[model samples]
Target: MAGDAEGFTDFATSCSGRLFRTAWLLTGDWHLAEDLVQETLGKVYRAWTKRSRPDDPAAYARTTLVRTFVSHRRRRGSAERPTDSVPDTPGGETDVALRVTLLGALGRLDAKDRAVLVLRYWEDRSVEETAAELGLSAGAVRSRSFRALDRLRAVLGTDADDPTRSGVAR
Candidate 1:
């Protein structure tokens, strides 16, 4: 039990920056990223006091962050209207090619699909871990993952058979 406090300290110190960056990427807003990180850490802190392993704190945290972001989107999505116009870019100077491509592809995904893809690719979690985190069966995770990847490829205009984008090697 005493180790839990030390675990909290270590986990917070080690993973905070990465978590913040991920949150920023996920939310696309720096202020919201701070809120997400703070809220996620609070949930982590509560879980840490009762959790079984210090080494697995990050696993718990990542799951919580995904869950939190999904819940946030659901709560806020109801008030949002559909957009018909293409989004305006502020500067034509900087080449935002990769960012535009990735964000465009990601925008086409449902919240759950986005979470699944992000966890699978960005966080580099295995199918089993992703399934466990999302409370899904392994088969469901596998099916959804390929479907999500296919959608990403279609949006990115990449051949589905391409090895690099196939996500098998990388």
Candidate 2:
């Protein structure tokens, strides 16, 4: 009993940073990211008590995180659709600046597409795992991946299908 408690405590502590990072990438707001990560941990804690034979708690937590983000996005609807703050080009920014630009570009994409891209590129999940995680068909994952990359390219001021660009666009 004490061992399980300590194990979960350690798990939560170690996972919190990563979970928060993922949440921030998904939501793009610091406060919301904090809230979402807290909520995800709360959910994971609840599951830890009842869910047995849990293969990967982090994976389960990630799925819950994505679902929570999608729900919040749906609730916002049109309000989130307009973010005039993003710039059109990379300009004279440094690498961190370029990352910010890319993240803002990701913000313009559909929520599902954003999730697919984040899960694939950021989290580095394979297509099959992503499909299973998102409850999508393998082909559907491919399509979403394709379209999301295109939108990301357009947002980054690059041609979506230009082979000379990083494979992220082509």
Most TM-score-accurate candidate: 2
TM-scores for the candidates: 0.73, 0.81
How many steric clashes between backbone atoms does each model show? 0, 0
Stretches off by above 4 angstroms in model 1 are: 2-7, 50-55, 81-96, 157-169
Q: What is candidate 1's lDDT per residue for 43-85, written digit by digit as tens?
A: 8887677636445778777778878887887887566642322
Q: After superposition, how far is residue 91 of candidate 2 from its true place, in Å?
A: 20
lDDT of 1: 0.71
lDDT of each: 0.71, 0.76
Against the hidden true structure, what lDDT does model 2 obtain? 0.76
TM-score, prediction 2: 0.81
Task: Please list the Cα RMSD from the true structure of every candidate, rounded to 1 decimal place.
Answer: 5.0, 4.4
RMSD of 1: 5.0
User: What value does the lDDT take at residue 25 in candidate 1?
Assistant: 53
